[model samples]
Target: MGKDTDIDLMLRFGQGDETAFRSLYMTYRKKIINYCYRFFFDLGTAEELSQEVFMRVYKAGSRYRPEAEFSTWLFKIATHLCLNELRKKRYKNWFVSLDSEEGSVANQLADPSPEILAVMEGRERKKKITSAIRALPGKQRAAVLLREYHGFSYKEIAFQLGQSESSVKALIFRGRDHLKQTLCGEFGEGL
Candidate 1:
């Protein structure tokens, strides 16, 4: 089963197959959540937003059209929700934790080993990358994430973003340039 199967399932759900909706939900639940997580860097918010996406899908079932792939449509909804949330909150700062279960403060204190230092360094790099991405203008961030992280083609991203393909290309190019400048400044190396 592939994209066509998704369309069939959506059409079936539209026609009142509860099981079809369930199947679609189960299939996309984690993907949507992770996508939202990347946008907000918060698992709880991501889960909540993903629920809203499915809710919209459920409510719009009857009107759902196969104008695009189901995943593309689903992501469009997710993107809008995420962008709206950003505007509503206007979070000025976000702190990403550098600790993991294995790298707890107590453990680090007990053994300030080279391996632990490496792990900490890796987390720092990730933090810098995440911060750089978050600093991008919303549309550019969305375009970059959709193209680089989500493996979306320019056409698909344009469709999801309601922009022209050339515009999507420009957004991604500018986004990448911004990220490169920011990350290179921090790391003193190419991204």
Candidate 2:
């Protein structure tokens, strides 16, 4: 457990040990869900995507290899699925509705008071950041998330992304630059 036995568990599962697969799934399920959630900012979609990742894991267990850390390989699968889903969404022009006919949660809950206004402003800033990240090209977004959010090393990210280390660096740099410009433009020089 100290040094990541996920590879061992995966190997055991590959040898037809069902409990190893269950243990592996139990260990990484939440991490996978949250990874997907951070990637797309949708709980439902994140859950769905994580399930698909595990499904792929289950199906491919027989052919699993230990070329990298299991987490890195697992995330590579998730990343590819995420990029493909983003491409599909882009083509479909999908949009998630923030409000229903009744009204948005913010509108219904707000009393137009001082404290509520501060909370609303914070939410707005977060929304802006999410929007900026969502606007990034799929690979750039994946690179940034793997490095910044998941604490992945440059080499690990490059391996997970199937890109050279230099390419991963450039993607992260460009992603950060775009976020800085978008957020700073909204927040002014103080940002």
Candidate 3:
């Protein structure tokens, strides 16, 4: 009769309703997995982390509260895990893969276009943007990804990141400015 809300579903799960857990997992599984993928650009690790995220959610069952939205709580858990993993690599080596469909830069630039150089330049631009994003510090990158890629509001990002809205705004602002500088140079058009 009524559409099921995430809060309602979570509450049901907390009550030991297996169907509710299944529904909740199905609803957010792909989203959290993809979100995690953006961090490592690796499907296997992302899948592992996403599975852990759900495990944390399941463990938090009886303690779950609706103080924040379900998405927000879930992402908070995911962000914590991702940040922890990133911190471990802060000074260590990290590399990007070159899978054509999976974000490997070489694969991204490998395809030829009917327009030849023009299409190549367009892909180059995309590659440049990706490089700039990679250059961003993890928190700034996370802020930008949450706000831009995931359609999160500044307020939502702040809530998810445990920061003030002003802080989230500043992070996004700085991150965008860095990207603009990297892509746009002194003039409007990219060099």
Candidate 3's TM-score reads: 0.79
Best by lDDT: 1
How much is the lDDT of residue 184 in candidate 1? Answer: 82
Off by over 4 Å in 2: 89-111, 188-191
lDDT of 3 by residue, 1-191 (tens): 12248888889989998798888888889989988887766688889999999999999998888877788878888988877777885523664432223334435666755576566556665555666676677889889888788888888888888899999999999988887876675236853
Which candidate order results from sorting by TM-score in descending order? 1, 2, 3
The estimated TM-scores of all candidates read 0.88, 0.85, 0.79
Candidate 2 lDDT over 1-191, as tens digits, reads 63268898999999999999999898889889988887788899899999999999999988998898888988999999888888784524544443232235557774677776677777776777777777788889999988887889889999988899999999999998888886788789765
All candidates: CA RMSD in angstroms?
3.2, 3.4, 4.8
The list of candidate 3 runs beyond 4 A from truth reads: 1-4, 90-126, 185-191
Q: Whole-model lDDT for model 3 versus the true structure?
A: 0.78
The per-model lDDT (C-alpha) reads: 0.86, 0.83, 0.78
Relative to the true structure, candidate 1 reaches a TM of: 0.88
- Cα distance off (Å), candidate 2, residue 57: 0.9
Top candidate when judged by TM-score against the true structure? 1
